[model samples]
Target: MAEIRLENVVKRFGTVTAVDHGTLTIEDQEFVVLVGPSGCGKSTILRLIAGLEEMTEGYIYIGDQIVNYVEPKDRDIAMVFQNYALYPHMNVYMNMAFGLKLRRFSAEEMDRRVHEAAAILGIDELLDRKPRQLSGGQSQRVAMGRAIVRKPKAFLFDEPLSNLDAKLRVSMRGEIRNLHDRLKTTTVYVTHDQVEAMTLADRVVVINQGVIQQVGAPLEVYDHPINTFVAGFIGSPAMNFIDCRVVQDGPNILLDGESFQFPLSATKDGMQIFSHLLGKEVILGLRPEDIEDREFVKDQKEGIIKATVNMVEPMGANVHLRVASGMHHIIACVSPKTRAKAGENIDLVCDLSKVHLFDKETEKVISKSPITG
Candidate 1:
């Protein structure tokens, strides 16, 4: 396995910038994922590293070698694409062995590598089957096997499971993670799905509009987002943002808005930053899970606020509810036991310790508290 690095990487499509000043380092044996919305340059960045697309201006390094001048074959990298670009005429064994044949490996060497990779991918049983006979997941595995057989310095995956059904995608997610663990090959995977990025990556690179936004472990980025874009992008239902001005009343700092005015509680973790935003316009970010049904937090309650229920979404184990405190509409993930419904006013208390505060202009997180419950 080898480390990959991009320095001042810039890719342009005439007037439009596909990747802007992209610079990042992928450590040896690291599973790094590049994630963002479409037209965000994720695929272009991957192609730059794979030597598939030439950068307008930048340097890509594989290990200690600068690969800008190197051909894809000489770069020692294998890529698995969103579409399983398999040979329909060839069976699984031939498909996996084709790369080795192109490299002119001995017959025995090709057989050994093909079978080993098939075993690793658990596709040995389907070796004789053609791509037409295999399911979407199987075809994906074969695509991966094609890469694995090469024993390249690194692996590049571009939404390899996008074609599979939701159920199969979920199952394949686990399989891919397991495969990475066993192989421990330095890998870079690109996807727009936050769930896939969070679950599969050793480090997730959040990019937007051809620029790097944040790079961190999944939980680190989720808990401490750099800005509003990432705050809304990383989470499942996402954090709720409410516009309000701060009001200092006695020892408490209150957030006043058209709908409601509430005191901001200071937690031990965020006391340092909380002291700075005394009377300023700040955005309040609360996750759905951070706001709980009063009944659940009452018995094991920490901090609570009362509001009127606007809507309720029953999601199996918990109910997602939208509530209005004044003019502010917030979402809360409460216990399925919550009997409150729409058109009803209820006390919806938020775990203040779990709340996040961000600057209105910069959109940067100013303070956050860790919640145990």
Candidate 2:
């Protein structure tokens, strides 16, 4: 295991910049995920680290050595691609042992390593099966087993589970996490799926338009996003953004949306925190989970918004409501017992204490209410 570091990394293709001055460190045995939408340069960064792509400007370090000019084979890292990349003619055992064979390992040593890796992955019985005969999940395990037997300094996965079905993806996610726990190998995973990043990463590096947005623990990013982009991109249902102006209602400060108004602060300190934005427009952000159906809310005195339900999706444990409040469309995750239905007016209680305020011009978070739940 080794720590990997990138210093001022920049990758450009002709006139387009793929990665812009990215500097980060992956601690030894830590699992870091590079998560972003397609064409966000996450895979480019991985390839750069693996010595597969030349950095336009920067230095990469594996342990204490600078490897900018190192050949990929000398980088001591194993990469698992989106496609399994298994040898079609070779069975699972040979495919996993091929790397060792090329390295000229003794037959007995290669045999022991291959079988051990297969057993760890629970695929010992599938050793003789060809890639064509294996299911997607099984093929993925073989790919992982191939990487494990090499015991490289770091493992890079480029969306290894994308080919699997949803249920298999979830199951494989657990298996991957378990594999990491047992091996404790340094890992860098690239994926566009936020759920995968949230569940798999020790630290998630969120990227957008080839730029790093925010790097934090999943809950940290979810609870306290650096900006609107990070706030909207990290959540499942996504946060609702409403345009509102800060106004003073006698002694209380309130956010005045065209359709609704909510108190910014009832306490002196809360008022002081938001006093600067007295008459300026700001964006109010509320997560779906933070908005509750009025019928289920115990305290209905604050942050009430009346909306016409446009659609209702009944998830097993919760219901997703798509409602319109004047011009703003909002999604709220309420309890499954909610009586809300399409075409009916419903009241929603937005948890004021969990609200996020962003500067309208910069779209950067100016203030975040303390988390109550």
Candidate 3:
């Protein structure tokens, strides 16, 4: 496996830039995922690395060699696409062996590599089945097997599970993770699905408007996002953001609003950051899970914000409640066992340590704390 690096990478299409002054180092044998919303250039980064799209500026390196001028074939990377791109007439074994045949490997070597890859992917039993005859999951396994047979320096996946049904997508996600673990290839995956990025990546690069917002472990980014964009993008149902004025609470800081006012705990470094925002409007970010149901909260915990329940969504194990605190609306997760109705006044306790404070104007996270508030 090779280490991949992009230094001051820039990709431009006419007057518009698809990737803007991006720099990142993907470690050897690391599973890195590029994630963002639609039109965020996640796919563009993948294409650049694959040599499918030339960069307008900067350098791309694979291991110690600069690959800016290298042809895609010589780069020695395998790419799996969202469409699976299988030849309908060919069976699984033939499809996997095609790349080796083009490279002119001996028939014995080709067969050995193809069979090995198929076995690793647990698709050896369906080697004789044509692409049209195979299920979506089977087709995906074949695409992966084809890439594995070549044993490239890196693997690039461009939303490979996107075409599958929800259940199949979940199953394929596990398969991809297992493949990365067993092979330990330097893999770069691109997806707009935050769930896929969170579940499958060793590290996730959150990008927006062709620029990287934050890059870190999935849970790390989810827990302590560097900006409002990341905190809003990384988690399901997204983080709850409410505007408030900062107020002094003894030596610490408190967020005061129309319906609620709670002291920000001194334990969180955010207190110091909020010092500058005292008496000024600041954005308060709290994840749905961070806001606990009043009944389940511990009194010793600091910062309790009260709100009126506005809506409820029961999601099997847990219930999601959208509550309004004065003019601001926030979502909190409640236990399914506890019955909650709309219009009910609910006490939503905010974990001060888990709170995220953002600059009202800059929108960047000022607090150094690494977990979701």
Compute each candidate's TM-score over C-alphas: 0.94, 0.97, 0.95
What lDDT score goes with residue 108 in model 2? 98
Clashes of each: 4, 0, 4
Candidate 2 Cα lDDT to native: 0.93
Which residue pairs does candidate 1 place in steric collision? 259-326, 259-327, 297-301, 305-349
Residue 32 Cα positional deviation in candidate 3, in Å, after optimal superposition: 0.3
Alpha-carbon deviation at 198 in model 2, angstroms? 0.8
Considering every candidate listed, which one attains the maximal lDDT? 2
lDDT of each: 0.87, 0.93, 0.87
How far residue 134's Cα lies from its native spot in candidate 3, in Å, is: 0.4
| TM-score of model 3 vs. true structure | 0.95
Report how far off residue 314 is in candidate 1 (Å): 1.1
- lDDT digits (tens) for residues 206-262 of candidate 3: 999999999999999998898999989999888988887887877766677768876
Which structure is stronger by TM-score: 1 or 3? 3
User: Least lDDT summed over 10 consecutive residues: which range in candidate 3?
Assistant: 364-373
